[model samples]
Target: MHRFKTLIIEDEPAIRKELEWMVTQKEELALTAVADSVAKALDLLAQTTPDLVLMDIQLEDGTAFDILHHHPSPAFRIIFITAYDHYAIRAIRYGALDYLLKPIDQQDFNGAIERLKKQEVAGLPGRLDIARQMAIPEKAVDMNAQICIAATDCLQMIRLADVMHLSGEGAYTKIFLQQGKRITASKPLKYYEELLPGENFIRPHQSYIVNRQYIDKYLKSGILVMRDQTEIPVATRRKEFIINCLTTLK
Candidate 1:
């Protein structure tokens, strides 16, 4: 009898530990490699395609959304474990196979496991059919899952594509957008570097990744001028790259 080898993709340390406990408590299931973030999970999946993946919807790097793109399982079976309530019902109705909400009971878990066993006899849904249709909300791009920004005393909605530049101060990243609107968030520049859409932004200074579309003008001395006349001090190291980026325009 082959055991159901499971891989857990979760960011929270305590949560990951509990998942390991859940899998081990079952006689028919065995725990496999655990990943702390989506990138690590993607790498591990390339090497060891587990029979089942227990995923947390919210992750440090991004959401468990990318997993659905794999369709059934890559190895394809997926069980979403989320704290958010509404997504649970959506997960099941959308043919996700199953979901386990937080504060998980042993009985509910055992039931899901039994369902997994039952599905094996019936054959699982072909994940390929659903994987092809995974489309994100397209109004504003949020590939990194960084949505709301805290500005002054209020939190404001933001789209990654609308942000024109990220300027790093001591501990905060000042986000400059296309409409001459600027906001500051408590997150660091390194955090934005990981969260921003990579191709659309280019770092010309230690404090900046000027959005390519918003570069109003560049002078002979390599100073960047925004449409609103906000002068961005470009780093000496990034002169050529910035020049090339501006010069190669259609």
Candidate 2:
């Protein structure tokens, strides 16, 4: 029985503790070191080479990219962890690396571990380049914009325009699509709210962010009617703003 040495780099204490607990649960994984910042991560990397690194894309001092770039030829497998952003997902896919969105699910975690157990990593430079480009904070052109949505068995790509609405349940969000389908994503509603095109999407309620194009009508009862005929509540405070956004869209 071989145990893979693993390092976890995350800033949040609660998240770090949770990851530590999860790592302990896996008999095949051995937690070597945990660091909260890029500088500390570098020091740890210098001390011991881990077989796998569970890194947070965004760190306090610098990003996980900084650490990766520091090591020209990284021998370890990297599994990026982040809140919920499409750009990071795209980069991870491009790099042939695995990623787990925040509010990590046990199933997804197990799946990623299983993949690492079987797959041989290749194209390190290419993947790293894509990640670097993604971290630059530029909105991708609409036509080229693609979101990697995680499902039970695989990652699916969906167009931005096809997303009808998003509903939040604590840390997870359920994305409703125009094709009468829904996918549960392991990211918070706030994550998608910030990632989606602002001009077309609006946070009508704390639990819901609706696509303006899919909105059919706004009822006086502070409810929005979707093209799919789904009734989503509009926050009292955001009613005026929602109405205004709808008016502009019209």
Candidate 3:
């Protein structure tokens, strides 16, 4: 691995020193610059982009989010630092390798550093906008429980919500929406599980996917129900997790 260089963008001197100590302790990393404000960070970025940045969300001038908004990376990587567990900050952190919540846990810090070290910025897949990706299907993709389908051609666009269940058709997948609208997607069922909002869905089998809101009731007899009364067989082993997720809705 190449020697990783780091920039610490933090407002507090004590925290900055602590981060510098941590970085130097790791033989692979070199602490290059410390900026208490975004202006200084931006100036350094203009001169040279570092391998990684240990960035605090709130700065004297602006947020790390603001910095990220203006400058994206691979030329530079970010490890967010925040005192709060705000969801908006979390979403941004997800786009990067990791984050260090303030009073950073040593274990999490070590874990984050380890993750930053292993990353091949080029290999991590580029991001997909949540709205655009969700729009690939249609109607209630964001919230509202309406049936979702975007018909753009001669062929019908199947409503995702109408889906009774999803089943693996080999390595590919089939969407089993109501009124017998079964469509095939090149992606795997696991892909949809991650993309879909968890509250509205469930993974009952390695080969099958389910929508929890459509579930009528579950029976220990091993069958799950849908709005149309479609019966989906649940893999006994997957029942616990699926049951727990479904119970969260109630």
Candidate 4:
């Protein structure tokens, strides 16, 4: 098996140590270098060319984007590590880049590495550009904002405004859009509920999240009628809250 040369860039002492241990534990990965800040990462990048870079979003001096901006054309694949920046996480998802949340789980880390190994390096620069653009707070929640859906075969970037509703199917999410199109995303509905803007999207039930723009009417009998004539059940506990929300929208 070919071992990929890996570099870790993280500022937090505990996280950096944990990441280093994880990388070193993987037989298919070779720990080439580690950096605690953007400057140190840039310096390491100049000295060694790693096959994979596991980097955190925020560093001591600046963000990981700072390093990428300086090195316009990088040869390595990137897997972002973040604690919880809504815009940044959305940006990474929209760009179709892999990411691991802070206090990383070993299983998730391994899965990310395996997925990176299987993916091709084509179109990375363009994806990175999209990430960089969407990372901007103002642009992230705009009308033209999009979310990347990981389908079985391909990644689909769908405009937020185009999404009508999302249904949870165990571990997956079924996204309903205009023109009767549907996408089965690998992520769960809860993932989207948190990622989407709260002003436009609302969770009426544990298994369903609907876009306010697509709602046609809410019946007093605990049902929401969508523009496409789909009837979504409003949980009994959420009836009052949902009704108030719809009333407020009117």
Top candidate (TM-score): 4
The residue-by-residue lDDT of candidate 4 on 121-217, one tens digit each, is 7767767876887788875366466666777667787888999999999989999999999999888888888778888899999999999989999
TM agreement with the true structure for every prediction: 0.48, 0.56, 0.56, 0.88
Instruction: Indicate the worst ten consecutive residues by lDDT in candidate 4.
Output: 139-148
TM-score of 1: 0.48
**Clash number for every model?**
4, 1, 1, 0
Best by lDDT: 4
* lDDT values, one for every candidate: 0.68, 0.81, 0.66, 0.88
Q: What is the lDDT of candidate 2?
A: 0.81
Residue 166, candidate 4: Cα error in Å is 1.0
User: Compared with the true structure, what per-residue lDDT tens digits does model 2 show for residues 98-216?
Assistant: 88989888899999999889755454555566557556558463524446665444555676677889999988889998778888887678767766667778899999998888899
Better of 3 and 4 by TM-score: 4
Q: What is the Cα-based lDDT of residue 169 in candidate 2?
A: 94
Model 2 misplaced regions, further than 4 Å = 139-250
CA RMSD per model (angstroms)? 14.1, 7.1, 9.4, 2.3
User: Model 1: runs farther than 4 Å from truth?
Assistant: 70-73, 121-250
**Pairs that clash in candidate 2:** 95-127
